[model samples]
Target: MTFTAAALIAASIAPSISNAAVKSEGMKVSMQLAPTADARQQVLTQSAVQFSKEMRRLWIEHILWTGSYIVSAISGLEDQQQVLSRLLRNQQDIGNLFKPYYGDAVGNQLTTLLQQHIMLAGKVVDAAKAGNTADLNKYNAEWHKNADDIARFLAAANPSWGFKWLQDMLYTHLKLITDQVVARLKKDWEGDIHAIDQNEAHMLQFADVLSDGIVKQFPKQFQQ
Candidate 1:
């Protein structure tokens, strides 16, 4: 994002004076004011820190709710739908975070993609539960494709976020999620816990990357 430098000027001019005994004199004064570079940088640093924290919080919520939904769905728990609803809402929350930087349309597009990701994950879980290899494979492939689309969309918006890097991160995210599902199905509690721990750490890193990219892309917004 680019910012136009605007000068705020205040000026005053003394009234003209005419007199035979005194020399006429005129005075003009003007001043332009703006924040100092150091002040601006301080504000930018604060904003970046806040953004990083918020992103980490949101992404961490994403993984936690998702894990809850996975456990509920696999175990045929009564609160599965409620957990799923909360998990889906996290996707919109993440998208809303982008609106200030990317506008409503772009934010909504991301929400759609993330919603699709969640829905595809549901299908994969169902297929796995039902022992349907064909549907599981199909939905898993589509899930990966959705991840690719998300990576492409973000990379197009900010060059600081490299496509290959984002893609790899998203792929790893998917693998961790799959590991959780597989471990749960196999009744390996320790493995499931490990995957959950890894997923949370991975998503925190992902959130940091996203925050850094946004800070780079729109430096002016973060300035004083």
Candidate 2:
């Protein structure tokens, strides 16, 4: 699932609108231009695989990295600013993927909501670090609510997102995220490792579902 610059740049392989010269902007997108339909399919498959792989790497690694900082909470543990930067970068990557299909406004809005998701997860980690069960419950609920917002937002945008499935998938993402944080707090290395594996694997499925939905929803974008 390795994605080269060419693979990504060219992976917006969807047919152009009226054969217009293709281009992209931040969080905006279009489809790939392949030699043939089969080539296009291969490109899309690679795109989905790469999308999932990068997503899992970025997000799961984010949890592990940030969780380390939270658990330690010692001076000079790690650069907090750098952590935030990485989070933003990961999200921006996602927004860029969506931009072509959703356009700039929608893409930016999606990124904003997703940013809220990241902030909420940070809050959960903060609550866990404080050992405040009440706060943890509160923030956890908020985090879940954010997931619902994400679900509704996406489902409203594209029926292919499937409200129930997307909601469940998002919740699973949150739950596994919690698993990692809680395990870190409790020093449960086995549980943490297990959650990491689960989170990465499940997220790939989500990626596939998302890619499938996009392909189905906008057939012209992917099909000639």
Candidate 3:
């Protein structure tokens, strides 16, 4: 069984939302997109697939949140950094797990984003260790800018997956960075907050779940 792209995207972009929760929706759609399997096997098999150009695109989409995470940390508006740290670490771990799936082009992009994130994170950690507010702010600003560019590039290069997926998932994350997150950040900057948060995180989880579903259904296609 295989899912349609629209159903899969809906499931992936807004699982928490009503459209996604329909038992016959995403899972039904899953049959059309992939095969229906238990969640445990789904996780195990998808984990086995090597990263590919498609996966790399997905990775970049995930990493785009690095900006929001950094800003959240810098402003001390949220206490999710520890969770975010785990997420980042998991992404790094997954990158290694996925290295075998990517071609040279995809691998290079993955490597580039990973390096930038590491360097940026390191600087932030170092600033915190040294208690340098100025440095932290500087790096946080850079993180925001870099994240914006990365997100834009991702959308431009792969609009189908990037913006389409993002817009669909937007509903999940919009609640987190609502007036509160924006107001706080807005005080400092005279522009958009790019306030992606818990909802966005939830959407990413859906994407991961769907990707895993695809891999489980078509191991050979993904395994390389």
Best by lDDT: 1
Q: What digit string (tens of lDDT, one per residue) describes model 1 on residues 72-143?
A: 988899999999999999999999999999999999999999989999988877777776656766777788
- Clash count, candidate 2: 12
Give one digit per residue, the lDDT tens place, for model 2 in 87-110.
766666676677777799888888
Best by TM-score: 1
| lDDT (C-alpha, whole model) for all candidates | 0.72, 0.58, 0.42
Which parts of model 2 are misplaced by more than 4 Å?
A: 1-76
Local lDDT at 93 for model 1: 95
- How close is every model to the real structure, measured as TM-score? 0.80, 0.69, 0.37
Which is the better candidate, 1 or 3, if ranked by lDDT? 1
RMSD of each: 24.6, 15.1, 13.6
For residues 30-96, write the lDDT of model 3, one tens digit per residue: 2222213453354343334443334444544554555455455545546556646654664555444
Which residue ranges in model 1 land beyond 4 Å of their true spot? Answer: 1-44
